[model samples]
Target: MSVRLRLAALGVAAATAAAGLALVTAPAAVALDNGLARTPQMGFNNWNATHCSGDFNETMVKGIADLFVSSGLKAAGYQYVNLDDCWALPARDAGGNLVPDPVRFPDGIKAVADYVHAKGLKFGLYSSAGTKTCNTAGFPGGLGHEKQDAALWASWGVDYLKYDNCNNQGVDAVQRYTAMRDALAATGRPILYSLCEWGQNQPWNWATSVGNSWRTTGDINDTYAKMLSIFKANIKLGQYAGPGHWNDPDMLEVGNGGMTDTEYRSHFSLWSIMASPLLIGSDIRKATPATMAILTNKDVIAVDQDPLGVQGTELSNANGLHVISKPLAGGDRAVALFNENGTPATISTTAAAVGLPKALGYQLNDLWSHKTTETAGKISATVPAHGTAMFRVHAGGAWWSNPPAVHTSADLPLPYPGAPALVQPGTTTTLTTTTTNDGVLPGLLGEVKLTGPAGWTVKATSPTFHPVLPAGRDVSTKWSVSTPADTPPGSYPLHVSTTYYPGKSTSDYDLTVSVAAPLTAGTTGLGDDPWLSADNGYGPVERNTSNGESKAGDGHPITLGGVTYAKGLGVNAPSTITYYPAGHCSAVTATVGLDDEKTGAGSVTFEIWADGNKVADTGLIKRGDPAQSLHADVTGAGLLRLIVTDGGDGNTNDHADWANAQITC
Candidate 1:
């Protein structure tokens, strides 16, 4: 929940208190009390994944609704099944009324809406408040036909309306949108109104009473960078969103292919904590299990739907690390430990940093991992690159300061990059988990179990059953864990849980088990799709292209010093990427320079690190400078790190490229 300020468009009229142009200064801002959107709206929107494509049709809309119930989205509290642009025909009928696309909705719009209503779901559609819809195809808009279009939509049982900002014809944004808002209200039917002004006029400053939710930023694509950018802009606008009115930061892009699974989880976690609208932009009918898992996580979704209607805030965002805190009902706090770096990091913060009251013991419920553990006061996690560690923290009321101490830990020799075999695949390790009754009251211990993935054998080597653990006492259990012979060599996560008496109070622990595998050896190797970790200054790090713009897949070919390289990383300054050479690589080399796209306005320094040691440096490489050759000796190094630092000045136009990066193995 890092706060960010965005660029502005022209024709924006500055607001002043003397001009009577009201601005939101506090949570006292009032919303249209239509008794709708008591929480941020949730459901599906066919925009990001489908866009203005031909595949968007009545069958697709119906299929989404059918999948909502069958796929558990409905049971997960998704109420609206909405459709975005391209749903209307190019022209209206003879009655001067908007027309549903005849080919797409052959059965008519009402029939499709009626079908959705019949399935116990609400319906929504899209249009614009201007002369034409956003589609360049020139579909009719609701500019001069507000009342007529609103009446038509109410007749079709449309439950929501997303009024966009295109073709406004130089009209004042407030005037134009307010016209549609009044038109929809006068229709005598309740329709949740969403203002999609793209924050051009600073909608959050004045749109509370205008609609149920107002788009506070531009459209969102499915990329880690884009999602992160939107969260930055919206998280600070929490004072503007409430029960009846919300600030829309576009829609969800969970299942889209642009980002990794870990990034998608962070995206979902941020949106849920921010209380943003959860409009799934992916095609649910074709969603993968990983995608479905992210969209249907009820524990996280509960934070978004928490009746408190309080949006989360950014407690801190420093040096690519971020912490977000959302207050939930019943004195619970939803905390997010987000790592924006391209390297794995242990983000640590005290409970007080997250606005939690002092307590003897606190329960940290891992929303993503679904593990509950007790903590004395600290909240920390070793988060992966572009990953988030989310927890629901609650103060333990009756538990003593020390609480019931349950520690599930295992120790094995750490593996070296190329040292003799250590903890190789198909090996057995001993796991020792201990539990102690440090609480004031005596407690009876329940079953203590250690669980791993399929094909992994786990046997209790020591006694696990402890009927009663009196005060100031402890018990220990050891389990023999073996990896499957066919198991692929990589890091694996294992879980163990132990419960105690009285309320069946539970404590769960997570541990990582690494199995050493041979490293892949190569020359002229590059960091591409399968990056171990990454963090950038502006947008995503592109492959084989200059860091061109703020969107993924929007980069030019890798050009530097008037020469082009086929393999390298295109990144902005203030970036870091970690690669696992696993001691197979002896040297790391690259041709580095500022991308030609910057002309002569950017400056940066590129450096290479081996196992936490700086090995190569390109100091103050500016635009139009000759490409510099960087070679780092990474002998016996487990990790090779590439870094791009802004040259003293801020990171403006600082797009640097590593051309023809290679590893000598």
Candidate 2:
């Protein structure tokens, strides 16, 4: 006895727009306020688990809905039971209304919606924003019939909509998606609108006011590279996300079999920190124990559902190791350390480097291992290959007092002017940081300890300067810092700490040193520009390196002075590079090119501004085009700025490079 025949037959009423029904369009200045999904939406979708199999019938949906209640998933905040593609009839009925497949959905969509509602769960339906869905299933997409479809779904009590992109006939994405948004608003129903356009149109820039959650990348497979690539792309778009608007990096592939458990943990942890929607794409009816454990971990989920709604940012991606940090609502922070290398390695970072206050100690709670420990600013974890170590850090207490006010400043012999002191790899540089005591009583200046990145030798030359510092007195210490010859180009943290009496209070001074790649002759106009190697809001400028064709910035190759030189500054579109002369250079010039070796289907517009004035503007440069030469007379200019934007098509492969760049003093 098949469950389809045993269920009572049901009919769906045709839905039509009323006469003189004013179409409620999305507000230009704000997003649709459905008052739902204020945080990332949690639920179950059947795409990764069961993609359009014949068993995707009303009975299976009902079974999943029942499990949602019985298996305690609802209690854990998993609500929506979404049906992906293939639940609809091949074509519309006589009245041009969408029809569910008779054999699969014997009781119609409204009945399923009602049943899901009866269990206190929401019902979600999937449709293509294009002419047809990804598969040739019965689903007739809502391309030309957005109004009709929105009305029907609203009438059927649908609570959520996962609108995908497939077979869109060269139509503009913003227009089609905005049409659906306006149509859904016209229905006067509070449906959660999800934009699934595969992140093709840079929806993070335009879709905030249109949908609740917009996918920021293409579909994610259950592989390590696919999952990691999606995570990297989404993390960079954090500035565009907030409450009511989110950057969706596709659904969760945590329970899928393509990756190991360690890699899956990394996937889930990164996604949680990024505040992406935690829609599980696994079969909930028979979830494995490990999958269920990862999914139901409330501590990890709390990070995603944090009330602050701020997305995390990548702190570092050097040497195949990555660190990400997110600020929580209660002044706590979430940090994730990912080891992308093939071999297991020990990685460490300081709380100050992740934007925590330097003077305060922190209590760290491992979100995955559930271990708790307290640290005096330094945190270290040995992670497995392709694994992640995540922690929630709470401010424990202040280690230093107000009486012993310590003022610190760094002095480098050959300063790069306005930028931080530069330390070339394989060279010893003496870093002198002076600490001044402005307290009421004398204090002892104890030993100074310096901690930096791995493979770097940082020793305090004046370790035991037990000088009695009277009130209003100051003392200086020097550290001999040396980097390995093969250190990657980035800003590495150089943390300086020491304990002094009367109370033996710990004083900490945090600073950064720029490590530049050995530049070749004739590569730049200036011998070694400090601003070119340091991180200035945008990530550290990599010399002569291609961000590579694989979107994840893997296997980067070197570029030199030629038009096809292996390295320069590589950036996606909508990025800015500002260089402060720091009184070091008077004029700057560079050859900007769209990398012919790495870029595909990328177009960019480059602009140069000197002292707030537009100096040069390259209208548009497409892939394989000749490089654009530009020069700027930056005499007496306080700042020089370079802006790169997508050539009116959204940033897909907008890999831009700066070649033969130089500055003249």
Candidate 3:
């Protein structure tokens, strides 16, 4: 059988097992009937901004609860306040019951839940299905104490539970989560169960009956790339969502400072269209006016809360231009046009192409601008870079109806070569672009021009030419591009435009030239390596800092002999980095270290391989350890590999760095 089929079968088997577990006491019935969250749940979760910080306490939760009522959020449809990880004490009490941290929550969790309930909002708490939570404090989890914990939470009037996945002792996901589901049902309380497994086990396949909502991706940071990736991944999983269950792409980072206001609107619109649970990850107390406007838009929220409960589908996605259409109740549709590219372009489409009937006209209303227009055939707009235009289309057309003028007779195709072109610093490269006339018309003439960054020099060979570009004909142009010696490593935008004769029709093509850092011989810093890639890893390599481990003194420099190396690569746990020699190199040597300058608390085993063969292995470096020197013979070898792994213990502060790496021919 195919892998996908096998996975689906496993999901069905897991669901059957969960049903069997639920039927142990009584006949098998439907999953917990929590009348809450009939639509995607709207709430506030604390993790993105304040991660395991000591400030997450009773006072803070009450303050946020007060803000929800005073700031009009409760009336605007947000009703839950969730306290993420680190809410409990490090150990259980003498009676083996989970205890709230006295210092953080002096009034106890029951009092806090009462405060939220008094405000007409629900209370939620965080816990893992394993032996320990994700926090470094090692708080008690709900692995063996599911029945006691569920009963305790139900007694405390808990309305929601965010069950995380950490330290799960190799137990199957279905069994662990099903045990919790059965336990929660036994309590007979209507609590929303959210499975925060980070989408590792494709929870959507089996989590429909197991959880009210399941995270479809890993945690999201406040960046355009991260938000866009989550949206793209969640839009394809619509088949598994319904009224009681939803696909969660983690919390919303809309009001965060990493992205601009325009980008945030696109983020909100896409999330609403995908029918994702809109869990606000920002501090609502200090939300700016612009942020408030985007969050409280009634038109967008209505589409998300529509009774249909059908998630949106992608209509067209090409060249960073996307169109997502969500079917709403009352025969209306919510559409979003997204420009994920860095450069502006004119994107056009028709309503019929987006699953709307072409013969029947519709009225388009822009959700952000609150403007309405009538169209019969096509709608076109010039979208800004990294922005979106959202609209709601009704089935009937009205006054001031004007469709885009249809163009026939001629078509122009402008295609650029080597998209996202890569080059080394201080190097010269050649860029070729082609323009063609794929139409029946005879007379077509145009000129192509290239524009790039300020410090770089770009000159085209032809620059100015009036060619007799006819039907099904093409022409190519070349440009000599060069960057300065001190050019920084980043993606630089390059715009190419063509203007034709007669109609003076213009077309644009956007290109990004990536300048890579150069790696040479003699004392090359590992962090400064030109090419760095990771498998089963995240984020970029850092200079003098650990990537995932945020412990103090874990980001200090590495010292060997008299030279102190401050730049290197830091990984989470089991990750490998393969280095490709820039030029001809026979051997490479480096000093590897664990943790920071002061001391190393975690152990990491380092291995070096050359051309698929193991060259060296440093057994295991323990805490408070110095640097270890290792060398690998790379004679005629195309690649050199460096592997670091957690040494028996869990991946806490497993920071491994290679210092003062160099290549010798």
Candidate 4:
């Protein structure tokens, strides 16, 4: 089944599963925690600004907390001052309670909380739900002391708690987390709990009842690729997002340097549509004017804080051109037109295309321009290359001062039909639809009639505009026919006609349907895993082999069998490497690159090992070369080993590379 179908099936019981997975206890009733459910969270997290370098001493936090009130952020609806990781010392006091690091937070967390609370803003703190504080610089982990930690936070006046999955792992991840959730409740403090487990456990399906929101992906970097990837990855989880619970794609990367202003606006637009937490990660003290404008765009922010709280959905995509439409409060709709290709292309669609009913008329409000104007019935526009156009459609004058804009459509139903169409059997196709109402009015609807040859049946129906157009609005609709399975493998012409009312404009569009037989495509074996290698002088160097030498990073590969043991496969090199494998393998194992602290890239080779034996070994090598890289294949059920030798072949003493290698997968 499709991923969407799977998620829909799982959506119903997702909360129950979360409740079962979460640690349950009588929850605390802290007064400061009651406001989150009523508003879209607006706050600050230090990770994007300072990362692991985040510090929260009296001097630093007092200044930040003061800035929270003075910087207009508080007035603009930002109230939470969250301290993310790295502020705690290694151990707790004799009372078995976690304590702030004296060097970093000398005044004590309670004092800091008091100061923040006095400023009219709430204070938030971080911790892990595991035995070890998350990977932050010694942030405390409330493993065995969940209840104690929860009480401490409440006593300290914390209004929000960011519970992360720092050192916690294994099958019991759910239970370990639930323990902290229940503990926080016992404190009688209604802290706005947040889950930061990076979505590994599909938190959206079960995180709402436990916390306000959960990170749906790994920490996002300050780059366009990183930001966009996280955004796109959460699209499938849209159904689970709402006012009380949200799917977090991590904090904003707006002014952190990897993109341009337009891109940032696009970023904010998408986030708004997704109803994601508007937690600014940039340094508020030094925010450039441009960055502030992007973050504080009143129009976009309005959409984010919209009362309806419905997340946007992907309407359609053809040949790299994509469209997403969202419903806004006050009978309006938000549409995002995008071009994901290298070249510029025209992305045209009517109000009806997104499912605005015929009874409604819409005015296109350019969010960036902050201007509201009538579309003159011209709801289509061309999108630029690698760019986007975002507009807020206000229904006919209901909420807007002006009327909808109008542009003439000379080629009645432009783009002459009889075009080659690809249709799935048993599925009805939606034809291009449009709306005439321009300003602040509801959507309209027209009739769609389809004519196809005998034997064709309509299994499912769709509007050229998704979200069926609401009634009583001024809108239009087109129709498409679904062909039958027994139809011959040839072109079959079908007709799609629309009848507009009042004005009574009749238009007919033709589509050439091809009943092409489905054919199976050939496949290839698994591609080489980036983690393993069999090149250079490092080929399956058996642990007990005479020629093999045990080296620093190469000593004792963790496992006994599987690709995890591949010789040159370990990444002790300075470069970042991400290890993932195909299939339902139990573990993934590899050794570190044994090269000495020296830097510079060159040929690096390694051998592949499975079940403690050599499976594939490479020839003469070099790093970056297709053939010289580490490659491996191993059973998901067992161990693997690799004994890599640094530099090139025989005779020359190599930098400390791998030798005594083993891995557990």
**Model with the higher lDDT, candidate 1 or 3:** 1
lDDT (10s digit) by residue, model 4, range 167-195? 77453555666677788878877788788
TM-score for candidate 3, residues paired by index:
0.65
Which of the two candidates, 3 or 4, achieves a greater TM-score against the reference? 3
lDDT of each: 0.77, 0.71, 0.70, 0.56
RMSD (CA, angstroms), candidate 1: 7.9
Better of 1 and 4 by TM-score: 1
Error of 3 at 557 (Å): 6.2
Select the stronger candidate by lDDT from 1 and 4.
Answer: 1
360-461: candidate 2 lDDT, tens digit per residue: 456777788674545556555656557888888765554233224333445556422232345667888887766655443456755566778888887778
Tell me model 2's lDDT, rounded to 2 decimals: 0.71
Candidate 1's C-alpha runs over 4 A off are 1-29, 70-72, 92-96, 129-148, 165-176, 198-201, 255-265, 287-296, 317-322, 337-565, 569-577, 581-638, 642-657, 662-665
As for candidate 3, its clashing pairs are none
Q: Which stretches of candidate 2 lie over 4 Å from their true place?
A: 1-29, 397-665
Tens digit of per-residue lDDT, candidate 1, span 1-665: 00111111111233213111122223444568678999899988888878888899999999999999998999999989888888887888999998888899999999999999999999999999899988889888899999899999999999999999889898888778878888989988889999999887888766776789989776676656557767777887876677888888889889877788889999999899988889998988888999999999999999999988878878788767888887777868888989765444556666676767777777777898786655666677656657898989887764343334343333333332211112445778776766655444566765678888888888998887788866555677888888877786566766777777656766655555556553466675674524455667666888888886567789988888778787899997667776666677798888998887776477889999876678889888777789999988999887667888877554667888888888777
After superposing candidate 3 on the true structure, give the runs of residues whose Cα lies further than 4 Å from its correct spot.
1-32, 399-665
Identify the candidate with maximal TM-score: 1
